[model samples]
Target: MNFEKIVQERYATKTFDGKSIPQSEVEKLLEIIRYASSSFNIQPWIIKIIPDKETKDKLSPASFDQPQIKSCSHLLVFCANKNVSENIDKLEKLMIANGSDPEKAREYTNMMRDFEKGMTDEKKLAWAQRQTYIALGNAINGAKSLGFDSCPMEGFDSDAYAKILNLSSNIVPTVLCPIGYGTDKPKPKLRFPKEEVFM
Candidate 1:
């Protein structure tokens, strides 16, 4: 399907049929999410995929007992990785390994490091969380492109998620996305006109 159709047809799925998406398809969708844009290519996000019913059951209450949590085939927990300096170092190494000139890679990574130094911990987390949303955008759109359904949800307890998932302090849960075959139909699109949205 074309991009326009995918965007127009895709909706925040309210409920999903209890069906498992194929592992191969899930991986493909993940690749699409991985390619999401980030500032300076820092890519400060980690996604945790939950496939089992037991864990989803546990997470449902934390998600305000949302039906999507338990009904969807898989739940993707997007987290912001706050270890900005470490990621900058890793990116530099990756660049050199992929045939980038070592000197140029170091120069680029040094620039990123300098940028990272200016941000406080709070700012780093906020910035990383913003980047995580870009990936989440890809996930919802990619699900539709792959003929599945998805919901981007933030109506949850982040602290509870961090505790239940046993995530590290640096990996802050930013958002939730549940993907599967939608049992519910899409409602009409309620969006502002282009003229109203644009300045």
Candidate 2:
């Protein structure tokens, strides 16, 4: 598909078809995220997949009864790690795959860790969240490429999601992306004019 078409047609889907998202397709979407670019390649995003009806029900209330919560076929929760440097080895692997030599990979990886360590808690968490957004973009576009609809959400209660998934202190939920087929037409998306926002 042309890039412009992807951008123009990608809207936040609200009502989803009852059709379930295939596990394989979701996995492929995740694969897209795994290879997404991140700030300094710290790459600290984590994804939690909720497929059970019980779990979805628990999440629905947290989302303030957002219809997408219960209407979508699958729920994906992305969290940012407070201590992403713990995954140095994983980051190194990604760097190497992206064309870094072994020595360069090690040196750059240490630099990223040090940069993270120098940040205040709020800044570090914010940076981690920024990385997750990159991954989210990749996942959303990849899903659309394969003929799926998604609702990118941050309307849920993070604490509720953490408790529902039994996530640890270091991993905090950042965003939710529900993927499935759409049953209803997307209402026209309103936005500021490009010239007003761009410059």
Candidate 3:
């Protein structure tokens, strides 16, 4: 489908059919998310894809008992990585391995490090959380492009999710995206006028 159609038809799915999306399609959606743009190319996010009913059941209460949590085929927990400098280090190594000049890579890494140094711990987490939203945007839109439905959600307990998922302290659960075939239909497209929004 074209980009316009994807955007027009995509909605926050309320319920799903409980049928699994093809693994290949899910992988493609992951790749699309991986390619999403991020500030300084830090890519400060890790996604945990849960595809089993047992785990979904465990997560439902944490998600306010949202129907989408248990009904969806795959529940994606987008975690923001708080270790920004570590990712910058890894990116620098990748740059050099991919034929970038050593001097240029060092310069890039140093710049990222300098920028990271200016942030407090709170700022760091906030920045990482913001970057995760970019990936979340790709995820929901990408799911539609790949012939599935998705719901972008922030109605879950992050601390509970982290404990249930066994995530490290540095990985913060920022948002959720539940994907599958929608059982419910869209109501209508409601939006502000183009002029109002554009201005």
Give me the candidate number with maximum lDDT: 1
Question: lDDT of all the models against the reference?
Answer: 0.97, 0.85, 0.96
lDDT of each residue in 26-61, candidate 1, tens digit only = 999999999999999999999999999999999999
Q: What digit string (tens of lDDT, one per residue) describes model 3 on residues 74-128?
A: 9999999998988998999999999999999999899999999999989999999
> By summed lDDT, which 10 consecutive residues of candidate 3 come out lowest?
190-199
Q: What TM-scores do the predictions have? A: 0.99, 0.90, 0.98
Which 10 residues in a row give candidate 2 its minimum summed lDDT?
1-10
Ranking by TM-score: 1, 3, 2
Alpha-carbon deviation at 132 in model 1, angstroms: 0.4
**Residue 83 of candidate 1: its Cα lDDT?**
90
Q: Please report the candidate that would top TM-score against the real structure.
A: 1
Overall local distance difference test of candidate 2: 0.85
lDDT of 2 by residue, 42-146 (tens): 678889987777888889999999888887878889899887777777878887988889898999788877887788989988988998999889877777887
Candidate 1 TM-score to native:
0.99
